[model samples]
Target: MTRNLILGALLSSLVLLLAAVSFIWTPFDHAAMNIPAKLQTPSAQHWLGTDHFGRDLMSMIMVGARTSIAVALVAVGIGMGAGVPLGLAAAARKGSWLDELIMRGNDLVFAFPSLVIAILITAVLGAGAVNAIIAIGIFNIPVFARITRGAALSLWEREFILAARVAGKGAARISAEHILPNVMNLLIVQGTIQFSLGILAEAGLSYVGLGAQPPTPSWGRMLAD
Candidate 1:
């Protein structure tokens, strides 16, 4: 593996381990406050010291990692679950009104950024992690749909796809069996990119006060403070 990949793996593993451990234990209760200790410098008693609220920074950070991970993970899942099938259908029906409709819908969604979408949803739902996830997920659907459709289109004309059609396999079957497998590598790469973007999106929402609420520490909120 490349050096960058190795370093990334190690760092990711460390973060995952820290988040997991946080569920069972932390240096101190993340929400517990000791106002007198606020802004104390890092020391043996508090490796990362204290925040302005006097909460343990390290504990807050540990819990925050999981919160970010959970939001990003679920948002990406929502995107892939909804987007992949829509893309496949559009690709299979290429040139049909169905294809036109799906693509046009994607275009409509693409017009709005995730932040804009978040603001709209949060306006109705009130700001929270769930609303942020929904916003990010909606934005992601068009992205994954576009990627899947484009990749699937190239494979549609391949000899194997043509042969599958001749063998009485339907569009859905061919897409699931043939097209999806061929495009999976591309999707995996795209998913990784999306996952990172999801984290950033979550952070942005939190920073703007549209994400996880107080008592549920967020990296973005920490930065804001």
Candidate 2:
């Protein structure tokens, strides 16, 4: 299982590698249309053939990869940034009103469907990459909140954590100095998982015209059309 996870990570990294490399070079321009070459089969020149619009398919895939990676990274970053702190606070406070407030807020956010939330956000904010990022990022917040809270709950009971409490440490300070450091690894693993989910969600949004907008050559948009 661990070997499989490692292999999956490597394969995923390769897609990002190609996408980053695409910034420097692609076999053909992704935007330029070749009407005469429309729908051409894969060949030495067009490795993945051409789309119905005569855009080089391979180029589209490479460029699309960039958008996917960017959206996922930003969305996951937002989740981690906001969720981790909320979760740590909840754990540190334990039975306090702050814990209940944070957790109940998370539950409320989680109650909404992700797709509906994205659509609503895009509708209000206007459909584009920025809105899509915000939508996906918002959806991820509750997920990380739950994960972080669960993980932090256990760590809060550890000897080190208790010692920090006994050492005249404030809740916020102890959480920052102790809890965060302890759960950093867990957060990273969760980040990677959320990153993948964000990519899929971004694609779904794009497929429905709520993501990166036209001319961006998103993978979901490509698949949609």
Report the number of the highest-lDDT candidate: 1
Model 2 per-residue lDDT tens digits across residues 1-225: 999989998998899888999999999889999888999999999999998889999999999999999999999998888888888888878889998998899888878887788889988999888888998898888788778888889988899888988888988898788878878898898898888888898899899888898789788899997
Off by over 4 Å in 1: none
- Please give each candidate's TM-score: 0.95, 0.94
- lDDT of candidate model 2 versus the reference: 0.88
Cα lDDT tens digits for candidate 1, 57-150: 9999999999999988898899999999999999999999999999999989878776778668766787899888888888889888999999
Candidate 2 residue 23 C-alpha distance from true site, Å: 1.0
- Residue pairs clashing in model 1 are none
